[model samples]
Target: MTTLYLLGSAAPPVLEIASVIEGAQKRGYDVCLGLTPSAARWLEPQLTDLEQLTGHPVRSEYKAPTGADVWPRADVALFAPATFNSLNSWALGLTSSFVVGFAAEAIGKGIPLVTMPCVNAAYAQHRALDRSIAELRGMGVSVLYGPDGFEPNQPGERRPEGYPWHLALDAVARRTA
Candidate 1:
């Protein structure tokens, strides 16, 4: 089975991450969950359920190198609700978190990647946002944002009920093909 490293950040859409996993499973991916620190805290209550659903432990931090890897090698990496902090940090190759660490290595390893940012209009307008997107795209990461992708929401407003979660999976499928 194809393995997808499903990395998530602290964005609101992380609250509905089950849907993203389900969507990827339907596309024939064996999904493994990697959460940013804040996302792990937010998802604390659902960890067991998520583990059962994915048939693997949700990893929020790096494991010691003494043991064999718990999860299979990722065929692709899909990052959803990629936050501003994570995005910029990732672009700058900061591996402070497991998700970013994995992403940084994945890029260097030439593993296919897709990212969907969930930033609001104001945050999206930051200068670093554009540079990060450009840098990642230049390095072959398929970033799903802008007019054809996710539109920025207004500040203080809840995320739209219609966030396009499947776009990430579709982009992965296309890249891996």
Candidate 2:
């Protein structure tokens, strides 16, 4: 089976993550979810449901060093709802969280990574963000943003309903193709 490491960050779109997972599964991918701490907390109420759907636990924190691997190695990974902070941090090689750590290493491991950012226009305009996106793309990370992917909204606007979860799955499918 094609195993996907689906990483979710603390963004409004994290609310629709289940749909993304189901979409990927329907496309013949087995998924393992790795959420940033805040994202995990945001999805707390549905963790059990998510686990049942994926047949594995949703991991936010790192397991004990002695613990065995919880999920199979990823064939591909998608970082959905990739936040401004996570984007910049991952680009800069920051591995403070399990999600970011795995993302950073996935690149070196030759694992295809697709990032679907959910930042607002203001955040997307930050000088660092463009550089980060460029850097990740330069490293072969498929970043879905702008006109062809996700179009950012103005700051303070919440468009959780408008988040393109299907786009993330499509990006992964294209990359894996």
Candidate 3:
């Protein structure tokens, strides 16, 4: 099966990651779930099930330098609900977290990477956001944002279900096909 590295940040949409994993599986991907540390904690209760669903361990931190990798190499990648922090950090090549680190390296590894951010309008207004988006685009990453992808909600408001998860999957489909 084609392998997909499905990564998420601490955004609310991460609560529904099971459905997204199922969606990727249905599309013929062997999903490997990676999360930011905060997200791992939030989904701790469901980690075992997620690992069972993907047939691999849920990873949030890097392993020892001498250890072998636990999951298979990814053929494609999707980072949905990438918070303002994740998006900028990835673009700037900061590998502090496992997800961001893998994403930064994936760019150089020639992985087909796609990202959809879920920031509220308030955080979206930051100047760094635009630059990050542009930088990732220049690196050949498929960033589904603005009117074409995720539309930011009001700062204090959230509708995690409204995140365009399918858009990211569809982009994955295009690349994998």
Off-target runs (Cα >4 Å) in candidate 2 are 159-161
Model 2 worst lDDT window (10 residues): 158-167
**Which tens-of-lDDT digit does each residue in 107-159 have in candidate 1?**
98989999999899999879999999999999999999987678899987875
Query: For residues 1-177, could you state the per-residue lDDT of candidate 3 as single tens digits?
Result: 999999999999999999999998998899999999999999999999999999999999999999899999899999987999999999999899999999999999999999999899998889999999999999999999987899989987877567888999999998778
Per-candidate alpha-carbon RMSD to the true structure: 1.1, 1.3, 1.1
User: In lDDT terms, which candidate is top?
Assistant: 3
Q: Rank the candidates by TM-score, best first.
A: 3, 1, 2
In TM-score terms, which candidate is top? Answer: 3
lDDT-wise, the better of 2 and 3 is 3
Please provide, for model 2 over 44-151, each residue's C-alpha lDDT reduced to its tens digit, 9 standing for 90 to 100.
999999999999989999999999898998999999889999999999999999999999999999999999898999997789999999999999999998877888
Any runs in candidate 3 off by more than 4 Å, and if so which? none
Please give the CA lDDT of all the candidate structures.
0.91, 0.92, 0.94
Ranking by lDDT: 3, 2, 1
* Model 3 local distance difference test score: 0.94
